[model samples]
Target: MDTLTNIRTFLTVVRAGSFSAAARTLDTVPSVITKRVDQLEHQLKVSLFTRTTRKLDLTEVGERYYPRFMTIIREIDDAFQDVTSSRHRIEEKLRIKCPTTMAIQYYGHILTDFQRSYPGIRLELLLIDRSVNPVEESFDIAIGALPTSYANVEDIPLCPLPRIIVASPTYLQEKGMPKHPSDLIHHDCLTFLAAGNRWQFQGDKGPVSVDVTARVSVNDSHVLMHAVENHLGIAIVASHIAEPSLRQGLATEILSHYPVPDLWVKALVPRNRRGNAAVEAVISWLKNASQPAPPWEQIPLSKITRQAPS
Candidate 1:
C-alpha cells in the first residue's frame, strides 16, 4: 500500500464528504477512492468513517486525526514550494475572506491583478461583513478593518481606513452642516450598526465621542453612502467608500477639522500559515498596492476638503 497516497485520499474523502465526491475531486472513480480509504483504515486497524446510505460522518479517532493530517499535508506542500519557488512558479490554493464593501469598492481589482500575475495559484474569496475566525473557517487569510487583536492570529496592517463625515449637497442645504461633532446630535444622522448611535472623532484637544440619533441604521458601508447620496442624513463613512461621491460633487465632507478615528485594514493570518509562501506573497502584493498611499488616499482631495469649521 502507498501509505502517503492512501492518507491523501482519506483526507480528500473527509473534505469532499463522500467517496463519489472525492473521486470527482481526485479525477478517479468511486471504487478507487473507496479502496484507498479502506486501505488506510486497515493500515490503522480502525474505522475512520461511519457510513450510511444517506451520509458519511467521521468517527472520534478520525475527528482527532483530521487536523493533524491537514497540518502534515500543508507542511509538505509548503516545504516543496519554498524549495522550488525560486526556480518555478508557485502553485497553490489560497482562501481569503474580506468585508463585502471593501471587496467591491477596492480589493476586487487588487485581487484580480494578483491572480493575473500568478496564474498557477487558485483563489477562493469569501465576502462577509463580519469578523471571521480564520482557523475555524479554514481560510488562509482574512482581511478587514479590525481594531482589536485576535488570539492565535497575526494581524498585519495594510493601510489606514481614514473616515470622514459626509452629507449630500441638498441635505446639507436643508439640514445645515455640522460645525463640530456635537452638532451631529441635532441632525438626522445615519449610523452603521456596528458603530451604533455614537460617532468617534479626534480633535486638536483629544478624542471625542458624540451620541447622535439615527433615523437610518445599516451594517453596510455602500448602503450608508447611498443613503447619504439620497439625502437621507449625515453619516460618517470610510474615505475610500465616500471618495467617488465626494469627487463627483454628489456628497460633501463636513466637520473636516474634527477627523474621524481611523480604522486599519489588516490581513489576519492564522499562526500555522505564518511562513506560507502564498500567504506571504499575497500580503506583499497588498502592501505594494497600498504603497506611497492607498489608491483612494493618493487622489488629490483638494476639492473634497471643506473649509475648517469656524
Candidate 2:
C-alpha cells in the first residue's frame, strides 16, 4: 500500500469517528480504508484502532500516536503554503563587493537603474579593489577583473578592459616623446606601484618585460590619471577613464612597443550561492551595458569634446 494512503486513512478515521464515516468522507469504500489502516498497524507493529459494531475508538497505542500525526500533517500543509507565498513575493536584500576604483566610476548608474527596476530588492554595495575573499567577507557578489588566483567561485566575465599609457599633451611636449620602451627611463613617468613597475607586454618577439622608472608613483589608478592631467607626470591607465581627456586633445598614447594585458571586467559570485537572482541580474546588466575602451587604445584625444571639471 502507498505510504501516504495509510496516513490519510488515519487522519480521516480520527476526524469522522468510524471507518464507514471516514470512507463516506473520503469517497472510498469502508473496506479499502480498513485494509489501509491494517497495513499501517502491521508496518508499525501496533494496532491503531479498537472497533465494535456500535462505535470506533482509538487503541491505547493509537491514542499516543494520533496527536503527533495530526501535528505533522498540519505542519506539512503550512510548509507548502509558506513556500507558495515566498514564490509570489520578490522582496530580497542584495549585497555586492566591487573594486573600489571601478565602483566609483560605474556603480552610480547601475544602482539607480537597478533600484528603479527592482524596488523590492535592497542592495548593499562594498568596494574592495585589492585581494578579497568573498566567503570570508560574506558578500553576495564580487565585481572586478577576476583574479586567476581565485579558488572555488563562479567568475563571470562582463567586459573587456583595454589598458594603455596616457600622458598630457602639454607634459609630453615639455618632456618630449619616448622613441622606445627603453627611452621611457629618460622621460617623466606616472606609474602604478601595484603593477610592480614592471610593464609586461606581447612583443613581436613574443613577450617582453620592461621595468619603467617614474618621477611620481601612485597606488590608485584614478589618482594617477589626475596626476597626468595636472602635468605631474605621464601615466599608464585604462582607456575608459581617460576617454574624456583623450577626446579633448589633452592626453596622447605612446610607443607601439607591446600589447598590454587586457583587463577583464568580471563578477565573482560564491559557488554555493551562484543561483541567486540579484547576483544574476547585476551580472546580466554588466554584460549588456556599454563598454568603452580604456584611454590608450582607440581614438586620439583631439576627437573628443572637452568638458572642464566642475
Find the candidate with the highest TM-score and give its number. 1
Q: What's the CA error at residue 209 for candidate 2, in Å?
A: 1.6
- Clash number for every model? 0, 9
Candidate 1: stretches off by over 4 Å: 1-89, 297-310
Question: Residue 16 of model 1: what lDDT?
Answer: 93
Worst 10 residues of 2 by lDDT: 293-302
Candidate 1 per-residue lDDT, tens place, 116-181, comes to: 877777899989887788988898999988575678999988888888999999999998878889
Tens digit of lDDT per residue, candidate 2, span 212-257?
A: 7778786667677778888776667887777666777777777656
Give the number of colliding residue pairs in candidate 1: 0
Model 2 quality (TM-score) = 0.60
